[model samples]
Target: MKSLRACVAALAIATLGVLASPAAPAQAYPSPGIECYTIIDSNGNPQIHCIAVGALQEIDWCKGCPWAISFKDDIVFPETFDIDVIQGVENLSLAAAAADPRVAARFHDAAIADFASAARGLGKQTASPGPVGVYDTAHRKFVADNQSWLAAAGQDLADGLALLQKSFGSRDSAALVKAATAEFDEAFKEISGKQVIGG
Candidate 1:
């Protein structure tokens, strides 16, 4: 009878040990900081703003730190400003033109037409067909369908441009021209659904 009782106690102890083991850890969640600026239309008022991750430095939280600034509001310290990361539209135009003369000419014509149409559509906001209308065009349809791949290629071109700019400065017209050619080729390949012609 004692032996039977001892065996039962041992089994209970083993079961309790298994139950007390720690659970596996869960996956972590993304916590994005407000590092970029975006314009917001608040109550029919257009407001330019920058958001911060936390309270402002050397400022009391009780005073409402990291306050949102507006054009109508008083100027404050730690003002946010726009950084020209991609130079400007002028630079982009020149680069695009230098890269592929044919594509540049096409883009120029298309952009003018698109802008005029978009502006007209904007006047009648109800008429704006949005992405569907934009994708209706044959050229734009291909871009919409293969957006992810094209975006990756675009990023690659941007990175190459950044490298060239860093090493040779923006004055290196030759490098800029070369980078533009590469960008055009990438875009062409993406649009044509053809393998890259060369390395």
Candidate 2:
């Protein structure tokens, strides 16, 4: 979604550049008279434009100027409106997420619980493995201070799912789960090393 907004903004800037760009010296020679006219811009504002007045045959070619552009369609960015709507929805979600730390904490806890539940299949096909280690004191403090969600959730979620494939319904499941923590030790370290950020 962010990329989509960026592309739209870039396209709009390019279009403005096009409209503002001077069409290369339309008239090679001076004309006998000057023609002046007023045009309504995309903004519904009046724009005054004057051009060399001459007969179609008398003039070789009269490339339009930005002040008096004669393009078939007006410059318009319909996507901007869509982006505005999307941003409104995004703003609401962002505000809700930042309202408190409960959401982030819950999400982290849920992911760990999933790991703990599936961790017993490490060594044996039907054998139970050891308990999953809890977050250390430092990691718990780091998380409490963060009051935020991790943008890295996507990768973490993927890792957890991959761990499941190793531990669940596999030979020596306990070993497989242990090997996956993403091995538990690494997850513990990750939580401790994770950074705290402010909104």
Candidate 3:
């Protein structure tokens, strides 16, 4: 019994040591199949970046400036391509999802989280209507470089999402799912054509 008690004491101390240890560092944005592209900032300083996204989320620039890009056929794109085809129907309307509180809550929370994350993932920026910040130069160059693709892709994504939202608002599950799937396919193809110019 004394030995057992001593063992317990040892275990407690071990546990305490583990608890006191520093936490693992936060993960940086991954770039498995990504490529870094550079652009000159307003101050003529070079800015390099890669896009990042989480599952079931839209693509956006990474939070911090990391310095590597290696593509493995999984290049990120700026569209709501991560929405599930069948499950995304819940986003149609709050009233429509009232019967399934779980679905409603899941989508609601996810929407909130995605919105916040997208804002952060867009990288640091000053008030757009006012004076520009450091990152603005890179952003401007990115916009100019991919002007045509951005316009086309942005319009297509907007139209597709609007159609999906409208179908949901009408409580048309069939249309909702159809629109989501179509948008998924189109976004895949549209984004695949995007390129990061090395400026």
Candidate 4:
């Protein structure tokens, strides 16, 4: 799942280097606005792959900027018979909170509500590997071993949400942003250590 970070980085590199082609005959660009795929695994089970390469497109739109970029290979496709991972599960909650108008407007009560929702989502077990696979044994063990750290990081995220509530109630946008950023930093640290998977 963390490999999505690599995908994002690759998307950035490709966007920076490539120039638009005109013969494709598209408005603004020739790239597809969205990309999705459906494929079958080795076990004959069907799987769908959809990558939100435009995850940050909302932010860009909010800032009055429309960046045309291709989002190819945005979703992970398993070539081997390994467990399929859900990438960016952890950050999705935070991204939702950050996108909330309450957080942007600095509304204390609404901010609390939005942040609490995100916190709750973050507190749950977000990563679970597939059940039947050759790598399942090791993957299961890896998940079991990292449970403690994952729980700790979840707690940190929840605590950070509480801090945001307090800061917002005090009407301190600077403090709120700083505290939220710090909480993210702490959560990153908690996950990036010896036991965690993604940094």
Winning model by TM-score: 3
Give the per-residue lDDT digits (tens) of candidate 3, residues 19-136: 1212332222121123222333224344333222111111235232221111112223123222221122223222122334565466544543333332233233211111111122
The 10 consecutive residues of candidate 4 with the worst lDDT sum are 4-13
Candidate 1 error regions (>4 Å): 1-152, 160-171, 194-199
lDDT of each: 0.26, 0.28, 0.29, 0.32
Better of 1 and 3 by lDDT: 3
Q: Candidate 1 versus the native: TM-score?
A: 0.23
| Clashing residue pairs found in predicted model 2 | 121-173, 121-174, 122-173, 122-174, 122-175, 123-174, 123-175, 180-183, 181-184
- Cα error, candidate 2, residue 118 (Å): 8.3
lDDT tens digits by residue: candidate 2, 1-199: 0111111000001111111222333322222223223333334333333322121111112222111111113223232322221222222222223224555345434544444443332222221111111112222211111111122221342254356556567788777655553433232222223322222
TM-score of 3: 0.30
The true-versus-predicted C-alpha distance at residue 127 of model 1, in Å, is: 34
Best by lDDT: 4
Error of 2 at 51 (Å): 72
